[model samples]
Target: MTFTPTLSLYVARGFLLTTLLMLCALTGLVALFDFIELLRRAASRPSVGFDIPATIAALRLPFVAMQILPFAILLGGITAFWRLTRSSELIVARAAGVSAWGFLTGPGLVALLLGAIAVTGVSPLSSAMLARAERMDQSFLRTGGGMSSLAGGRLWLRQADRELDENGVAIVAGRPTAARPADPRDGFARFELKDVTVWRLSAGDSPLARIEAPRAQLTPGTWVLEEAVSFGADRMPTRPQRIELPTELTPGRIEDSFASPETLGFWSLPGFIEVLEQAGFSAVRHRIQFHSLLATPILALAMALLAAGFSMRHNRRGGVAQMIAGGVAAGFALFVVDRISAEFGEAGSLPVILAAWVPTVAGLLLALSLLLHLEDG
Candidate 1:
């Protein structure tokens, strides 16, 4: 018998509601743990109140929900299918000539819709909230205030000069790259900045001097500027072939100052990645995030299929609990594979596309194979 529109709607509604309910339950549980951790950290800071941790937890919930959505979809689909099978609704349809795939179509479409909404709508809002959360974290929780700023496709870094007893700022035209000869001074020339401009400020907050260089390298406790020109308040502009300025900044500190990939929205990532790469920074993490977002919908659909494959068996053939457990295990296995592939992708050992899409595609194929065996064997 053909699966009517009414039946499809029934299945779709069941899938949607169950998925939403599961998502809420999982997100709430995760948020509670996160809030507790934040609260614990806040306790050490006399200036922080309960409201600050609570606010941060609230802001982070949406991003956490998105991460948990796939498992919710899997469990929701399993519950939906298990219910239909136990009620003999699906079994009756099957006995009357309807195929498992017929009923699966509705849930699959709903899963796709959910995934699309998450990627195009929810991600942007969550990313914005996450960015705000990071700002609050840095301002209130971290020892240092903001140390870096990105504008007009340039990177700016703030540093304290202990040796000179002054504060300085630098603008970098491109990303920092590995410096040659590795700075024998301390092996600190791990990275070098390009098209650099440094500004030193006096104790009174006035500009003490301005230095510009085509290339600059970090060595132990100072910045070595090559072919630099210096402008000072009391002297005519002087051109120096090499100049060394005392600094407390290191390569690791500068890298840590950059914004994380998660703070940028999906729609904004492409442009941001372009600007980062143009400025000579590594965009690998951003590229992985973009590809992963693009693959979310397909992964959702695959999760639905896997759920159905595991839970749509006849009631007479028991082991329902075992089957459901298997589905959950499979979901976790997919998650582990995704993380491993992502690590490889970040390390440049795997292509970004394969790292992002391989697990989703493999899950879909495996689900199809299982369903085929059950339907025709």
Candidate 2:
């Protein structure tokens, strides 16, 4: 209430410490839950190692911590403010002429700072670790061994052949030079592969021919191999101007096969978006993710403000149980809204920026309204 620098620092430190404690507790709980689920999955698979679950749990703690920030900030702010109120410290400060706004300012700013750190410092680390954990977990669940991960510059795919062809089956390996997502409207999710290597195997699993091309595109029914060089078992390697290799891989299948956007880091998102757009893909999912990361700090600040609004009033005027329940419910509701909006954003059902920020902006506005009403009344 006195608006003193020392009082503000004390409030900020108390709130931050509480938030960190809650974060630690929540992360440990999440890790435990994940470990139990992993163990249950490993029970049926003899190939899974005991160390794999532990490693996955350890690697995923960062992601869990990042996910819990908004909730931690809300709970921490509520705890700190409720303590101050019950102890009569806040009342005494108010009597001493400090406004509610003055005290809440420090906590609000700290929440914003925590949000910034979550996005810029923790997000990339968490995303990368989660990606690796998922790949390993998926492999153990599905294949029981070996890496089954897919996402990034290099790619390998087996061409599915339905018809009997004496020429043999083809294996495709290459760097993904470009991609065009299905323009369902146009019926094509065209892609360009660079440094392409193709091996046609005989019925006995022997290599029949090795074909290399500078570029290749799988169209409706054929692989349009450009500047292709073909080497067969019994003949000299021959260069072809353009060769059409039979294939059944569709654009939708190729689109579905790419790595999920979640596996990519926040720092790398912009460049990835550019490349995706250049390759003629929609890049909607990446754009949504990037915008969501940018909005995280503001979301935390909104949660803090909402918590303060619910917990800062004089206790004598209200039902303590109801107030606490209401505050928790509001925090959860915001989280649900944010997730639903993100889903809409990713699906392209809503405009990217709007989907990422609508819930956050709405929460902030509601908090501001509550604060203003309290200040005026």
Candidate 3:
């Protein structure tokens, strides 16, 4: 490589390394604070284990790195450009027939490569780890492992009897937890509930029969309600009775309720969207997230362009201090625009793809305009 290309490559590599180091340091400090808080909360809870705190800390690093990437890119690019100007390396390259655009190619290529890695590789890993971390947090924090969508927590279904077309059953209970208990035939697939109430619905949806119980456990195809009270269809109170509920709901089905589409990676978003539609839930947020992931590279490139446009002027024309100030101002302005666009996108006022990409495109255009003015003028 020529001196210009070599210098640009060196500067770009240095910037990448510096940005990654700064991001890791800042994220590590924040993670330490978060871990301390998590540990304190775990200490307060009697049954909660220390494993959750460790898991949370482990998951936070990747998330923080993702969040800080744009800022790091901007700052690192500015630092590199500032150093080149200070050393008069850019001037030397220009004297040797290197155009401003020519010098930028190396760093731009680096940005593109980094952006690709972030979207395809880092994002999936982060999403998976974050999902696991969320589950751990919930299990350690909530009761009954939280409610599932399809089954487990007080399921109510109306079934018709053979003789009369009456309402079937209304089930309510405390502690309707789902777990895979040991079963002979099915091996291991069941949903169990404790402290259950089953109400048989009569004509006009009136409660015809009510069964109160201390425990009800669901097996592969059956629910066993124990220590229950039975009421007659005549709306009269009967003596205590126990019964079995015939149903197909299982623990896996219940767990599916808590599995959100956002927990999936970018690669899984399309399939997840199909599943969401089949399940009757909207996938708007997931679609937006996927688009945002695709836009990450463009956003990083825009930040670098903005930094260079604002900071990489010749010192003879503008002092180094002024250039640095201008760069900082430009970065902050871009950040504000990005935030506004994100809010608009989130509120559905703007198209998701447009909102995610507009700021980046705007920044790149602005930078190109400035570069043309500086170089050709």
| TM-score of predicted structure 3 | 0.69
Candidate 2 C-alpha lDDT tens digits along 297-364: 99899988888888877778777667767888988998899889889887878999999889899989
Top-scoring candidate (lDDT): 1
Model 1 reaches what TM-score against the true structure? 0.75
lDDT string for model 3 (149-243, tens) is 33544444333321223334443444655466567775866566666766555456665666777778766656678777776766566665667
Where is model 2 more than 4 Å wrong at Cα? Answer: 144-257
**Lowest summed-lDDT stretch of 10 residues in model 2?**
144-153
lDDT of 1: 0.81
Better of 1 and 3 by TM-score: 1
Q: What is the Cα-based lDDT of residue 301 in candidate 2?
A: 91
In order, candidate lDDTs are: 0.81, 0.79, 0.70
- Per-model TM against the reference: 0.75, 0.73, 0.69
Model 1 poorest 10 in a row by lDDT = 163-172
Error of 2 at 198 (Å): 12
Question: Which residue runs does candidate 1 get wrong by more than 4 Å?
Answer: 144-257
Question: Considering only N, C-alpha and C atoms within 3 Å, which residue pairs clash in candidate 1?
Answer: 175-279
